[model samples]
Target: MERPTRAWVLHPDIRGDDRRRAPEPALEEATALAAALPGLAILGSEVVRLPRPHPGLLFGTGKIEELGAVFAAEEVELVLIDGPVTPVQQRNLEREWKLKILDRTGLILEIFSDRARTREGVLQVEMAALSYQRTRLVRAWTHLERQRGGLGFVGGPGETQIEADRRAIDEQLVRLRRQLAKVEKTRALHRAARAKVPFPIVALVGYTNAGKSTLFNRLTGAEVMAKDMLFATLDPTMRRVDLPTSDEVILSDTVGFVSDLPTELVAAFRATLEEVTAADLILHVRDVSHPETEGQAAEVRTILASLGVGPETPQIEVWNKIDRLDAEARAIWQARAARAEPHVAMLSAVSGDGLDAFLTQLSQALRGPESDETIHLAYPEGRALAWLHNEGVVRAERTGETGWDVDVRWTARQKARFDAL
Candidate 1:
């Protein structure tokens, strides 16, 4: 039998400043989840930019009743709100609308929970989930918590289930921390290995669905998943990219940032975000076609600052998705590119347009000068020679009978190490 599409998305805006106007962007995120998951169909979505809230419902009682009628007529099985709702509000809303309800936090958590493929990722998601669930324990299970325990309240210590839940959550948190620590240790070792062959790490970061993963794959020829959805790529992915100047570097694709990211998620995903903290360069990919492009860029910068990425960190703003822009806007951005600050690259990652200019600029930034140096090495200095081979742009290598003659053009760090040797 065929079932009706029965999911409705809601975005609530608590009116304040211009920033609190419309939450269509958040509703769009919820719509992406509906697209990914099965059995739930999104019937429609609405934004309620209200001046005040109601106690029983987030909206006024009259509006709530109005939405209730709409839900009934539309046969909505689920109501996905694009904002965090309290446990009591969720309970009341579900009863009033006669449907399941999920908030922005819950939705984001579910996305993370689904996208977590690795053990560490799964553990982190579970830990975050448990932390969130501990507060909303009422939603999952409706039970009396005031039963007398023999040990503490009414039942014996062994029979106290609430204590067991608390204990279990603590134990899980400990285990997750230990596992994440191990993962961090392993990542540190890997980072050290990369340092030995030091390639500048460039990370692409932007708002969700900002085409970061697409740009990443376009640059590195990698097949990492790229979709037009919120939080498409959860884990960090790194790949080697050979620039236009024949300089090879490591380009990392990081998880996209969003406005009003759940605080729990920010802490939970710190492990994955360490890659961004270690980046030598950041490509702030902006969806220039998005109506909220400037606002999205502000959010990305805000998150970057909160992550302690200092002002001195070199960044190249890549205004992506120019293909989606109209001709006038594209031309205007192009004209303004000449005066664009320190580093701004306007290009369409999908079309491979203007990529050469961006790559040329990046290569020049990576390799400051092309002053070739004729370097001499003592006999049997294979280790130093190998280091040069890996880290430097070796123009020519000649193995003489007495020693080795190498003409290398590399970065300052590589030259310093070679000079030390």
Candidate 2:
């Protein structure tokens, strides 16, 4: 097998920026991002402090030369910058260092390029990639281990970079959008069909590698990609989870959120998150053991709000990955979680701890108004009676002269569906 391309990562911590994140944690996350790509080996990473970005080279001349010398001495072939790099900066940095350089947006696009599987996913990724390259078409993007020309950053052998001309890129975008529209229409139909079902949708969303997929797999017994890798699962996967309360919900494991997600990819992937908007409840999972967990959770909330999720959708905080925490930290989190009660549940998805309470809380949160009613149904309405029994809501029943008197306790949603029937 071909050796993984050696790479170095840098997170520029600009001074006097009120919104600046903790640089070390940011560098750690950026390193993880670099590690997520299959063909990249993160040799080292650093937080590069800067007074301000230079117009052409991003970093000052002295710093640029210093970094170039460092990369050369370490045999680094690629320098992955953790923040935005202007087209000119990318070009200049590459020219000076004699190494390929990828900004955060380009790196993410490459990861998505590697992970996207479904036809819709592939098309959306292609369109987003084209839009990204449209701005910097003069330079050849460093394709990875494939040894192909052009934007082969993540594709396999025989895959070639495409569409150099502005008109050509626009035409490709139009084609991809058209194909995606068909896929989306089919998805809408499937969603409409799912809506006819009485189950509630509970979407699992959190920062990438926050154990969303692990929790999902534990709850639903389906193996989704639960590796300790960023963006482990790109497409959303759903499974019917039968809660201990005897209630069932369609649990959706969506693409994970991340700090500073690229704008192009966010727009491309927005439609995939429609399941979230239509959900009855959102499970905001978190990696409680991580040092930057609070900031990560805040970022997830910000993204959710930006996606137009409002107060109408109820959300529960799932503090996951307690197995990775020390005893003292775990005790503190447990107590903190107790005070938050149903709204927050601290658990370890891998160890199956605290999941039961979390599920019970989930059932309560999703429970609509309960109605107690005695309904009269004729013998011909046996199917409706069976449905009530199947739902485990039947309390008592008595045969009458022409039909049956049924005592059932169910939620408002269940009542409505039965009424429609």
Candidate 3:
């Protein structure tokens, strides 16, 4: 087997910045990110203090020399900076340290490139990566001085290698955009078909490694890729689930949210996240066992709001991973969740505990006003009858000489679908 690449993670702690996160937790999260990428062995990690960023080298001369010696001693193959690194700074750092360097955006792009599975996902990542690379062409291509030969009659001077490379990237981006548009249209059609169904969509959204996929698998019985890693499940997955109230719902597992998520990723995944926006209900899953649970929750909420999820949208807070907590903490959280009924649910998705309560709350939140209605359908309308039965909306039925009388207890959407049929 090929050995893993030796890597070191460094989280820059900007001094006197009140808004800056705690250095320890930030460093821990960065380390987690590094571990998520396959074939990377974390040699070590640290929080590099920076009172102010240097224009050329980001770190002071003394610190540069110190880290260089450490890198040499450790035989590090790559260095991952946990924050933004300008092109010039990245070039200088690599030159001084004699190792490949990846900034926060570049690292995320790499992870996304590795994780994306669907055609749309692959296209989006490629487009985003190209867009990011376009900004660093100067440092990326060493053959910028090369120029193409041209005929004197047609052109005096041909384009340089850098210009040609940028043009090629831009052209590829355009093609990718066109292809993405086609895929999006296909997805829209699929969504439209799903919209015609009576089932309401419930989306699971949370921070990375918060067990959204675990809960999804527990509820839907689908083997989606769920792991204890950041961005483990990048492509969205959806399945139909039967609730306690006998109401069927479409549950969607979405990409996790993170603190300071790269802007390019946000824009690139907009189509995938539209599932959340179109959902009839949103389940904001939280890993309550994490030390930075509140901070992560805040970040998820901020991203949701940025996506235009208004206060009017129904949402349920799912406090997941309670199995990881101690008895005392679990009891306290359970009590709190009980008091916050209909809005919060404390559950361990892996252990299948408290899931019934969550389903009950989900049923309550999704169910609209109960409407009892009787309808007469001819013998030829078996499709509608089967739909009502499949949706678990039929309460009673009576057969007559000419037709069948069906009584259904359903929500307004179900009633409307029946009416349409």
Candidate 4:
């Protein structure tokens, strides 16, 4: 087997910046990102304090030289920066250190490229990658000085290598957009079919590695790729799940959200995330044990709001991974959750603790407001009676001389389905 490439992660702690996060947790998250990619063995990680960023080098010259020595001593093959790195800064850093360098966006693109399974997901990643690469064309093409003499048919002379590469990338993006359109149409058709099935869709969303897939597997009893790694599941998966109240729902597991998610990726994956927009209920699964859980939840909410998921959409906060917390912390959180808002549920998806309560809550959320209705059906309409019985919606039934009078408590969707039957 090929040995894993040696890598180092660095998180720049920008002093005096109001938006700067705590350096330690930021560095830890960056290291986790690097570890998520295959074929990369992290050698070390650190938080570099920067009073101010240098425009060209991103770091002080002394710091660069110092880190260069460390990189050399450690035999690091790749260096990942936890924040944005301009193309010029990346080029200069790579040249000075003589090693491969990837900024946060690039590292995330690599992870998405590796994890995407479905055709639409792969295409979206390719488009985003191309878009990202288009900006770095200057650093990529060493032959930018070379000019091509174009014929009259090409309509331009003195087109540099960079321009040619940009044009090629643009063309590739167009092609990808067309292919994505086709896939989106097919997905829309599938969604339309599901709409006819009379089952509400419940989407699970959270920050990366927040145990959404684990919760999904626990609820649906289907094996999905659940792991401790970031971006463990990129493609959306759906399964029919019967909730504790005997109401069936379509449960959807989506790609996890992250802070500072690349704009190119967000636009590219809009179709995949549209499932969330159409959902009847959303479960915001969170790793309650993480120190930055609140910050992570804020990021997820920001992304959702940007996707047009607003106050009108029903949502439940699923406080997951409580098993990882200490006994005192867990009890404290549980108490807080109990006294908190109505839609919050504290549970560990791994050990099945509090799953029953969660499912019951989920059933209630998806069921919406229920009302009792009395209907009289003739003796020949056995199918309608069987449908109501199978749905567990019948409150009471009385037989008469020619027909039956039934009292049922159901949501509008259930009533509609029964009427159609």
Candidate 5:
């Protein structure tokens, strides 16, 4: 039950000389996005590069006509524009190309629509899509009943007609928002439970397809969606990553950030983003082999800043995908990371190279002051045992003559509890 596939690329050469000059990165990003839909049978894809940007249509008349010809020749069923398209422009493009039109926002929405796993994720996607559709009501709409009542009169023939499409979209928006609020409450409850566990959260965030899920799976030994495709992981997946010292910490893999993410999508996904904002540490994973890694990193930073996870946050730069790079490139990256101490580490999540070093660093950062005391308490005093379970890692436990014999490493606050007993 897979949908029919049709794809096209429109890297609108926007007016800014510096901005338009970065075509290679856009192509690379698009390639990653295309790879995400491996199951879809893409007939063909053509990159439509405009000579210059046009605010209304994004591309010039000549370029649009030229694309129209190519679409006809290829029998393309969809046009994927890299830039945002206005309602008028989208309608015109659909009519001329005789296909469904999708800009970057729509494309991202489509991906989210397919990848959303949890109930909250699905609700978020639906809300975003509905909001987007509300704006496009002018382009394709239905006939509506007209009302022609006088200013003081209650009844008469209808003169003005309400836009059917707009009314429908508004109604849908209200319903979607109500559903999302319910889902938010459920997520809040789950988050509260995690907070009580006393485990610090570490969230993995980066540009799309940066191997966040792969690294997450390796660290936590849990299978998440990891692939060589943009947005391979959508819903935020959390698991307990066991540290070398036998300490368990909550690790989360979140939706990857992309350049120019639609505002609607961001607003909808705010609940999932709570993981990032609440994180005690942030791992910004980057694909070191990508030539445009710097630009990608900038994009991720921009999105994070918008989410309020600013520069002050405790961030660890994870230079991932090292296995794809040559020895010289690897050396260069290693040097770069060294110069950026307290913020960087180079590793290949796929091959498991340099993971131990990364993990050692991660554990040390998460660890607090060492403990000296060992205490034993009775089974009936289970509240104390539960408190110890959360405050520190339990090293050993056994039943003794009087009570439970326990050996553990705890913080000063937790060690003080023993004196209270």
Candidate 6:
């Protein structure tokens, strides 16, 4: 493989900024973001304290010159800023440091562009990139059409004016949305088909790198791309899983949330996250071992709220990665889980230690007063057979010259619908 581009991360901690987070953790997250994009080697990262931003340069002259020297000596080819960078600031910094600069939004858009797999995902990323591109003060995000990969932020060409770019971007966005709509319509048909099924949907959501995919894989036996990187799973993956209660459910692992997620992405990926909204139960998987776990959880809740996931939706907070904690720390987190409001389950998805309890709790949470029921129908009663199949309650079906013998298990509610049929 070609040598990875050397990159540095800088978190500008503006004084008295209510939105600011713990500088250290923010820097760490930023470093992870940079490393997430393939072919980028993180040389180093730092927290740059600023009483006030320089508006035009984003940093003082002395600090710029100082960092520039370090960049030159270290041979860093790229700099990833942990927050927004205006077009002017980006241009000035790139010239001052003589290295390509990528703001947090730019970096994330690049990763989404790189990681999106499905046709809809690719279109969503393209639309988001274009939306982000249309706002540039200097250079826009690399032309996504280049398909040159990774948003080409490191060395993108074709910098243009907004008025001209706006027209082009608007047109491209219209085309992309049209394509996305067709893809979404297909997805909607699939979802409609699934709606006819009796299986409840359980969605896993949390901060990126919080081990959701790990938990999802352990429960569903699907090899989704689980990694120690940010935004590891961009598109939602779903699998049919039978819980401990023998209750089959549609388990969905969705792209994880992040602090200060690019607004463009939040809006663009809304449809991708629709699974969470329509779920019967949501598993809010959390990395309980991180020093800033609470903050991360808060961010997840904020984003969920934005998506209109109201209190009416039942949710269980899955405190994950307890395996990373010490005995004492583990006890404290376990205690917290025991008493947490709503529902909380403690487990290490990596280790099988607490999985059984989690599964048992999951089953109980979805439990209902339902029992086995068998229905016999003739081949002429195809409508009833289709209903049973559509309801996903068919356990076994035997076809005879006269009719079909069908075994089904359903709740009173579902059975009522079958009775009506």
lDDT of each: 0.77, 0.86, 0.86, 0.88, 0.75, 0.86
Instruction: Estimate TM-scores for all models.
Output: 0.84, 0.91, 0.87, 0.92, 0.81, 0.86
Best by TM-score: 4
Model 1: colliding residue pairs: 148-154, 148-155, 149-153, 149-154, 149-155, 150-154, 150-155, 150-156
lDDT of 6 at 75: 99
Record all residue pairs in model 3 with backbone atoms less than 3 Å apart, i.e. clashing: none
lDDT of 5 by residue, 174-227 (tens): 887888788888888999988777577999999988899999999888888887
Poorly placed runs, candidate 2 (over 4 Å): 137-164, 395-399
Candidate no. 3 TM-score: 0.87
Residues 169-208 of candidate 1: C-alpha lDDT, one tens digit per residue: 6788898889888987888898889877757888889998
lDDT of 2: 0.86
Model 6 C-alpha lDDT versus the unseen true structure: 0.86
| Model 5: lDDT to the true structure | 0.75
Per-residue error (Å), model 2, residue 237: 0.9
Residue 255 accuracy (lDDT) in model 6:
95
Off by over 4 Å in 6: 137-161, 368-421
Decoy 6 TM-score against native: 0.86
Per-prediction backbone clash count: 8, 0, 0, 0, 5, 1
Selected candidate, larger TM-score, 2 vs 4: 4
Model 2 lDDT tens row, 337-360 = 889877898888999988788888
lDDT per residue for candidate 4 within 1-421, as digits (tens), equals: 9999899999999998777997898899999999999999999999999999998899999999999999999999889999988766776898899988788988899899999999999999998888877766644455333211100011222337568867887999999999999999999999999988988999999999999999999888899999999999899999999876778889999999998898989988999999999999999999999999999999999999999999999999999999899999998998989887568998999999988888888888777899999999999998899988988889999999989999999888888888777
- In model 6, state the lDDT of residue 307: 98
Model 1 per-residue lDDT at 275: 82
Best by lDDT: 4
